[model samples]
Target chain A: MSTVLTQRMIELQGLTKRYGDTLAVDDLTFDITPGCVTGFLGPNGAGKTTTMRMILGLDAPTRGTALVDGKSYRDHRFPLHEIGALLDAKALHGGRRAFDHLLCLAQSNGIGRRRVTTVLEQVGLADVARKRAGTFSLGMGQRLGIAGALLGDPAVLMFDEPVNGLDPEGIVWIRTLLRQLASEGRTVFVSSHLMTEMAMTADRLIVVGRGKLIADATVDEFTSQGEHWIAVQSSNPAALAAILTDAGATVQKVDDSQQVRGLKPIEIGDLALGAGIAIYGLTEQRATLEEVFFGLTGDSVEYHGMLGSQNGQAA
Target chain B: MSIADTAHTTPARTERLAVTNHAVPTQSALRAALVSEWTKLRSVRSTVWALILTSAFTIGLGTLFCWAYLNRRERRGDSIRSLLFDPTARSLNGVVLAQLAVGVLGVLVMSSEYTTGMIRTSLAAVPNRTVFLAAKTIVLGMVSLVVGMVSVFVAFFVGQAVLDRDGLGTSLSATGVLRAVLGAGLYLTLIALFGLALGTIVRRTPGAIAALFGIVLILPLIAQAFPEPWDVRIGRLAPFNAGQAMFSVRYDPDLLTPTQGIFVFLAWIVASYLVAMVMLSRRDA
Candidate 1:
């Protein structure tokens, strides 16, 4: 939507939540800025949803605060107008029609019925608006949830696992919707455990592991944090390995090829040329976002397979 | 349509919606909350079905009882009016069953959200727990009041019609008759409110229903097991027994006055509601 950008920023300051002895979120502090989609990334049980809940004031933090546009989310006079969140797609009265469900939330904020209809139409649920939410498939339910969040036309939107059960079309639809909302200059904060999902949809990402902030950077920067290595296939593997190691590069040798870190492909090519060894093939490999995610969150995973490596290696 | 087309059309639609700002008046939080809660209560099947059941039982059973009583008395060639036979109480006998339906409705009003995990959505909308709860109480209480009054009055009229066939019916102008009928309605509404409060405290449908039944039905039965003055004292103090005193046609020296009984029930409702609100604010959704 073409509109004036409302500068709303959500800031979490040392937010911590503990249930008895178990810490759900620990010392989380970050700012979600407007005009872009900021992905909240974490493995399951790493407190992404808990942090979102605290932001929406659904859960009280044990220590610290979640502020929206400088004040607590609950402190806003028109909270729905300031921030709209879909904490759970299925969190609705199943017996009520989808239209009535959004209407209920809309009326709470004194929003008009016309806005409800518009939102239902926007979510492509206008045809089945009268159907009970209980009968809706997961994708339809997710759309209904989005309809509720947009009921007030809030400047800030938060969605938790918006693509969880969506079909591919639904997934693409929400991705475009999130980007559209951000383009309208509204802050869009989406939470997901899938790194590739965030990589495709979010410009900036705030990643967490075991309730602690791991990285807060743009997608470009995040993916770049993954180890970049040059793979070299040489006529003389032994000479190339020595040359790379002597040049302060960590080298790992596999069959017929050497993985060299801390050296550019051009440097390796030059070193091979000086060593008088023919470079049969040379390639620079960058770690994928998925690999980066596994590397960052590997240690904090609540469950692990017996076959998985403990040193952050991809299984 | 292409993704580009969907994207192209969305902004125009958003702008159209954004143009008409409903201009919601800056009223008290409770006013907005009340509107929200009224929408929540009415848009569900449970409320409609429960009220229907309450009406059916209260009127149907009362009519049956009145007819049965008139038939039996006529066969014996005896007068229906007697010192021991409180016709008002007999005509309103259906309330004992009807109250359960009202109680279930009240409990479901709060507990259904818990079961469906909608409390998170609700609390996020209205973060002030006190205002949110007060609005719920007012909406449910108002609905229950209307339903209770309509159902009980219908039962009374139907029951009296049955008794009228035998020329032994009492009119609303008769001594204590109007009070008993109105009191029955008030009693039903109060009991439902009590259930709503218990539901909030328990946060589960079955648990709330069990606790409500314990207070409204089981406790009175347990009180009857005592002897002499203890039985009378405990029974008079129990929730259902004390509330029932409001609708009794005959005066009992052992029980509370109608006003006192209402106040006692009110105390129970207020206390439970406050505790529920306190616990609601204290706990995470």
Candidate 2:
């Protein structure tokens, strides 16, 4: 089947949302381009959901604009066909059958019923299509939500925490689905608080904190910003540490292992061999995405509880 | 099951990735939204039960009242010609119960969306808020009008059949009889619309239903507690009293004429609908 590639983009220009005194989304400006998955990363309460809501026109922006393909989402004649969003999995009347739930949304956008059946099959929900939505488990509900998103065959798809209640298999299915959608030249923007999850699924990351843009870069670029070091486990730890230190490398000895900086693993190995100190293991390490996420949003975490404290006491 | 397991089971999954680009006929937004709302209303179980109860209450209670009234007149040995009675009004009295059923159905149509957090999904689908609300109103209005007419007409026919056994029944050809019957159906439809407006404004099922009952039923009783002319003056404007004037053939100085009652009832609905429209548009889903 031939696929037509359209310019599907989500552009937010200084989009601001203020609820009374609290600014939920403060001057968020970014563009989500097509042909790749852009991960919307932020800590909890960092305004990720609020920004998505504004983009979908579920909430009015206090200041600036959120445009989908050069037009506001509300301005689209058939919005579901232009951009589909799964804001909340449970945002449907549970008394209705799963098929009927998707049917109504499809009809609203002038989509055919055949497409509804196709989406149900695509999401692996065809088996339970006749069941009431209220009886569905979280994973089933998520699949049903995805079916609704795919009903109109939209160009741009947005999912707010799409994998919240998925099992391992479901997670793998969604990850594959998201990457496949992006590979097909459709714009796929997914929001998640899990940095590790984004690291695996997103080609690009748009990180935010306290409703402010923090970093906008590729996944490799984001990981490269953190500290890098080489871990050396040697038979002669003391000798290697002294040799590595003398060779202009900062080395810290801990439990017969030397953590070396300012030197490559190959350099340390060559130096250790030259010094006649046998090395058992030479491994390079970089800061994990989880650590990098925390380091960037540390000051912006809205609610911080005392860690490892008992009986409401400060630690 | 793992991703490999799913892939093995569904080898045809690759075809699902292709988005259908077939040409579809462009429909008006209002028509699309109307079709969506109709599907949403019928898919739920509550709508079926509510509509069934509406018809059953109207027909069943009307038959019962007609039978009891005839039995009572026979026991009193009063001639049907000597007594002053509005048989049409008496037969259509079941509308009092039927109104609540229709009102509940109306309230649920709008309020359930808010309660289920479905408003977000709904508004996202039909971003034009005016068109969304208009479609919902049109669908609910049409359904209630049909059901109301069917219920009231069946009640009128059956009640007359029972009363006709005693040679005391009124015909559609009688003076003011057809208007009263038609007015009963119109009154129920108005009540349903009133409930829908309240549901949109309140956005909660229980609260909207309470407000509906308070305005339609309790307010009339409260109005009757006023002193002398103030009592009748305030009472005549209440929805329950206005509805009574619409379907009552008997002339009374304390009540409005059928036309006057319709105008008064319509004023109440218009005021509530305006507030509902404002709240629906301005508030976040």
Each candidate structure's count of clashing pairs: 0, 0
Query: Against the true two-chain complex, what DockQ does each candidate achieve?
Result: 0.40, 0.45
- Cα displacement (angstroms), candidate 1, residue B188, comes to 1.2
Which candidate has the top score in lDDT?
2
Colliding pairs, model 2: none
Docking class of 2: acceptable
- Across all models, the iRMS values in order are 5.3, 3.8
What TM-score, to 2 decimal places, does chain A of model 2 have?
A: 0.93
All-Cα superposition RMSD per candidate: 4.0, 3.3
TM-score of each: 0.92, 0.93
The segments of candidate 2 whose C-alpha lies over 4 angstroms from its true place after superposition are A1-3, A239-243, A306-315, B1-25, B73-84
Question: Model 2, range B20-85, lDDT digits (tens) per residue?
Answer: 443444898888999999999899999999999989988899889888888774436566643557
As for model 2, its CA RMSD to the true structure in angstroms is 3.3
